[model samples]
Target: MKMKLELFLVVMAVVCAAGKPTSKAAAGRNKLLLISFDGFRWDYDQDVDTPNLDQMVKDGVKAKYITPPMLTMTSPSHFTTITGRWVEDHEVVHNMMFDDKTNLKLPHKLTLKKSAWWNKRVLPLWITAQNQGLKTASFHFPGGGANYSGQVVDRVLFEEFDHPDDNETEWRQNIDKVLSWFSEEDFHFVALYYGEPDNVGHAKGPDHPDRKKIIAQIDRTMGYLREAITRFNLNDSLNVILTSDHGMTTVKKRPQVDEVIINKYMDLLKLTSFEILDYGGFGILTPKTGKEQEVFDALSKVPNVTVYKKNEFPESFHLAKSERLPPIVVVADLGFNLNSRFIVYVNKGDHGYHNGEMDMKTIFRAFGPDFKKNFLSEPFDSIHIYPLMCKLLQIEPAPHNGSLSVTENMLLGPEGPAGTEKPGSGGSQGASLSVALLLCMLLFMSDVL
Candidate 1:
């Protein structure tokens, strides 16, 4: 009887050992499709007319909200999303940038590879994914035009579309282009960025009728992507993730800009350009020269705007600590926005508001074979996305300042029966730690016995 019991115990141990998930399948090749819709708010996921995105939520996982960078501009927010680093670290803080050394202030262009202001040390996810020998592609990534050898970037389409200047219309073509590319290439990872909703939202405000129209347009585009993937028989092989850089809020009121107050300190400050631009609620005063302190003090005395130095910006904004950030960052009081000559001419609406307000919370969702069904709900940081994509494509995580990979696993659920290890919940490598402790305890017990 004792011999029989021993043999049964050994068989059970063997079965248990075989059932444990190993690192092999986790490190295996898998395809990833990362898409971002600019200015896509959290409210769009409601039971309204979103048939395409609603299906994705039912088929996969969705987050309550995703946080954006401090400045909340396209350059910075999108940069943070792709590289998992804040604007200060990546150094693309605003759409209009100033190079202090050259005394050159230039409107931000999506320059490929060579910009004095952008920090290239913080690599993008495509770089890491490509380094692992997986194919990669990007469509209209905010700064995706830059050709940094640091990340493994394969095919990048960075130019802006000319006709139909509406982003929603152009986005449909971009999505079709990406689907065609996916069909032709054996790409292991791909990213597509849509700038139209953000464009319309900024131009028409979040509550404008055009904002809802843009949402519908995006839904149709998403449907095309989902349908194309299915038709190509690549659905099972693809991990589709969708998110946005930031959200949009309505401009309830516009603040008057007193040219007299601006001029009082304008010449005292080394004058760059004196135009005031709406930076969401606050305005950005870029000195043609780098007199940040003078500009900041001048702006601080204005009605309800609080001035924040580049360094003084909250750490939660995750702006890289840098001297190059705009000299005077202004925050408008609630219910107020800055009325710039530029804004009056173009956008009827805009973002770039207080860094900490919940109004800026954006949307994030994932639908694919690897993602769990209807699992995630709580809000998460945008930084977590890089690591999750890396895991899906079997690439090394980008070296970043503490991303939230473990917290994001709520999207994946208890790791599948396949060899993919469950990403830990609290950011601790708990499964590995638990295994080590168990092994040590077993060895100690064996020696004593």
Candidate 2:
């Protein structure tokens, strides 16, 4: 009897010792759901009451501002958030990029079947996680469908089948599908994208009544998502991060501006040697061979616009580091857009301005097992978010520019420096103590017997 009891206690000790490490590893494997509301400005929640978002802020961490990468456009910004690299580093410098190497133009409208436009330089979080044996799903997210480094996400809903619109029911259906994915045992990470407030913000200005209505609708959808997470009891196990690619700003057509200023100079500057890509608020001028000075001299003289030689562009913006960038870049002042005859009507709102502009800032909110509650973080560069995602998922991050230390303070418990104990590991010491006590009790009982 004594021998049996001793053997049992020894086995129990081994089991407890083995189970503790598993628990620690499992604790780090929380589900992460990243949701992007494209063009959702940082202040939209402030302009309209967003109870669901407000509740999330009250329950999770909120950043004061998320400064998007330079160009402040959707594709580049989204890729930046995922890859933690600047436009120059990632090579997806604009929403519509032309690859000179393959002579293939990649527009936002291009199908996922085409992969040449995606940057082969960097690995996105989904690929990183997937490579580490985690299942990842992307729903209509930029770069989600494209295979990076020869590895595509485990599941993807390319833009052709899944496009974002103003329909709340359709949005809910997407959410339902995401929830169902979360229910799957193998689904570990997911990214969801919604084009909202952005679509309406373009048709109607950010402050327009219609825009406000859509913002409210977005808030309601968020509320539904929160309710569903609670209903499924996944609130503590799942992390939901909401952010936007860039914010929108009101824009007005500069009547005949392109014709009077840009067009007139184009003929005089012998612009045939240059490729001028105009994006309403900004333009990129790629001068062929020796025409750089000529293109810069003409556009630089134009009023209400700032022009920079590619090398002279602000280093802080991180825009000029890539050879793919044009020789000259021009940006119009806020509230003004470059005029083009092809445009039927000036968009009421636009982005793609200098990222430092406050109007270009976007939202950042996170709720999950890993984030701190009721904490408001100071403004930080969006590049840092990739490292935060890596930390939360406990995945080894690929080599990138972002530093986890920048955003580590926003997590709960000792996972952050300020916290008293490390997250998930807090229970391990207690578990050890319990096992020791049990061993002691067993030893005492055996001696008595």
Candidate 3:
């Protein structure tokens, strides 16, 4: 009987441990560093040499591709990654938002102070981790400064757009700051952002030689970061995830948005107002009351443009359900930009077009103790990253739109049983506890027998 009781206690402990979430820290991996390279295309590494990133893949895991949400703009894509929600759900529908209620226009102007432009509908990972008593930090990451659920990260840095220039000195500083937070302040989670390839990709086309040069420079920065991690003896303790918000596409031509064509059809329409919300790729045309059909019919005839009513937009895009979206959304074909007045020349590249095109797919790679070495995962949506982060940090995620199943295969374990809960379901603490109890009972009964 004494032996049986001892065995029962040991089994109970094992069952209890199995049910609890294991944080990187608890598992002897102390830090998680999320790094973003804006507009890094899925295939950019193949076009140029990225020895540092290549080494990471050799040592860790890589996803084939990460599909961005609809619109595919920088701000929306980054927000989707952090919150694991769609643009409409997060209320940051565009980089520049016009609030009809307050009659205020919020553009993507760089500001250090927090603004009400950010919606609190969903909680980002920083806030979620901080709420669970883990120290968090963010450097120039979108949604970093925003107070979600009345909580901000313990350390925050808002770097300006031009900070990455000057041989990437500011980029190195950002990296140093994040390392300090982990080593000194003991922050468990840190988000770092760099505006690169995207900047050059916009100024010079994605296929341009300058873009390749920029990618190489970014790779060198990655090498620097890897050296720093090793210097601090953090290579084993740190898990670094590198990704991009969206990819770039070359613009071969611009479709003229002829006012004359619209004016010709205006005689038959009762259009109260017409405004273009987004201009380049995913052009949004907000029309006045009851004139959606008239505007759609007119814009449908435009060259290189496809018009869809809000209700008629593609269901796979998950874009039509947002109140913040315009009634008519126009998307230009690949290698084309929408322009008004005359044929505007586009000598460079642009994004924010259709998300279905492969050119819009971005990079996803991770390295550290938790990931599988040299493992290449199938392509997954970027929205699924939030739940993965929550799992890695051992924090209860707020209600989000991501699913653990989407990224479960990327980890170094069994895929396990499928979760019946909906995507972005809140933390499964109750479920975990219930499973723990059942296992405990089963072990106890076996020992008694």
Candidate 4:
């Protein structure tokens, strides 16, 4: 009984040890706030009067634009930034969770709970920081709500599919809440998300008047956020990064051009056993047994659509290597999307286009005590962010695909770690993941027995 008591105390000690600021960079490191506004194009503020974003550019760093992974949809692209892996490696391949065998599908919001799809080996920055003894929170960031290994983000605010994105009042409330987390609760990292502009972009198009209204609202919220940061007295210690998943494109409508609809060319139901189509610029088809060639040939012939067998997918996409993918992949041209299986209402605007397209590029702006002032960077890939975050927090990264050297010049300090430093073993431990896991297992067994 005494031995058990000692073990229990040890376990409690480890639990309590977490969330304390012990960044390898230093004790009491500057807090990081990563904010993502979905579908915010690089040039959205070019014509609009966005004083807050403009102030961010003058106060901190702004990128010409950052590239997202190919097949650039919401969930996959966001996951790419968070995990620092390509689409195939992270395996959060699409906005929808799908089972090729059962032909089952779950939309983006529902898929957040499906950890098997999101956290298959590589963990996000929040988990990595928590393991290194820094507390982290996420508000509506994609994949933030799911469990990774044996842990979840220290704090999370999840949403449903129908949640409105443009609530200015609620947006300020979230800013206040996060400010409290940093000020009163002492969180080292917090990721906030807004579904704006993306929702308005889809329903009313990226260039529509409604999008301008939402942009104005976003700017106003930014003003409130900056003010709240001052009110919380976090101005000296807080570092803020504002970016987006992917940019939006105006979808080609009817009458003016021949809208590329998949069903118009091939009998989709007759071609494949399962499919994930009508979502955006990409689609995956699981061909019926012995009918693989037939499906590939048919989709390939569709004008403005590009088709590939899973193995034949472009290597540059970083998506061809995953076994979780369907046998057949279909890609539509810019300004086009695959639909017709269940076309209810076509979005006036959409993303999931090739990352090379100018319209597909998203914005990047960051400000903090650690970052350089008023520096404008050339374009960089979103993958670089993971390693950059790891560097800022002074935590070892989890063997990611991003390069630290790409963004090193923007920091205030002299370049420290080369991009090739070794990584953590990816368990929830500050020093040694294996030892931590073993201790955790022992605690679990003791409690159960």
Model 3, position 120, has a per-residue lDDT of 42
Of 1 and 4, which scores higher on lDDT? Answer: 4
Clashes by residue pair, model 1: 88-320, 113-146, 113-147, 127-151, 127-152, 272-288
lDDT against true structure, model 1: 0.66
TM-score of each: 0.77, 0.89, 0.81, 0.85
Over 4 Å off, model 1: 1-28, 45-47, 101-103, 109-119, 149-152, 161-173, 253-295, 339-346, 404-406, 411-449
Q: Can you write out model 4's per-residue Cα lDDT over 97-147, one digit (the tens) per residue? A: 889998889878888778877877688888988998899998998889888
Off by over 4 Å in 4: 1-27, 414-449
Per-residue CA lDDT of candidate 1, range 1-449, in tens? Answer: 57545655665565465446556345444577888887777785553488988888888888888777776667777777778776667777666665545545565453433444454557777776667667778776766666564443688776544424355556666766676666677777778876667877777787777778878877887788788788777776678888887777765643543321334434534554544454556455566555666666666776655767656766776653755555556667643566443244345556677645676778888877678877667777776677777766666787775455555565465555344654432223444455555655665566578
User: In model 4, what are the clashing residue pairs, if there are any?
Assistant: 72-352
lDDT of 4: 0.83
List the global CA lDDT of all models: 0.66, 0.78, 0.75, 0.83
**lDDT tens digits, residues 1-449, model 2?**
67867777776776567455445456446888999998988998887888988999988999998999987888889989988888888878767756543445555657334566674588889999988878899898888878665778889986663455878998888988888888755588899998887888887888899988988999999999988887766876788899989998987655534332465455533553434344656767666667667767877777777888878878898877877776777777775665432344457898877788898999999988778789899989899999999888888999888888888888876544354455565456666767776776777787788
The Cα RMSD of model 4 versus the native structure comes to: 12.6
Runs in model 3 with CA error above 4 Å?
1-29, 100-104, 110-114, 161-166, 254-274, 342-347, 414-449
Cα miss at 350, model 4 (Å)? 0.3
Error of 2 at 233 (Å): 3.3
Sorted on TM-score, best first, the list reads 2, 4, 3, 1
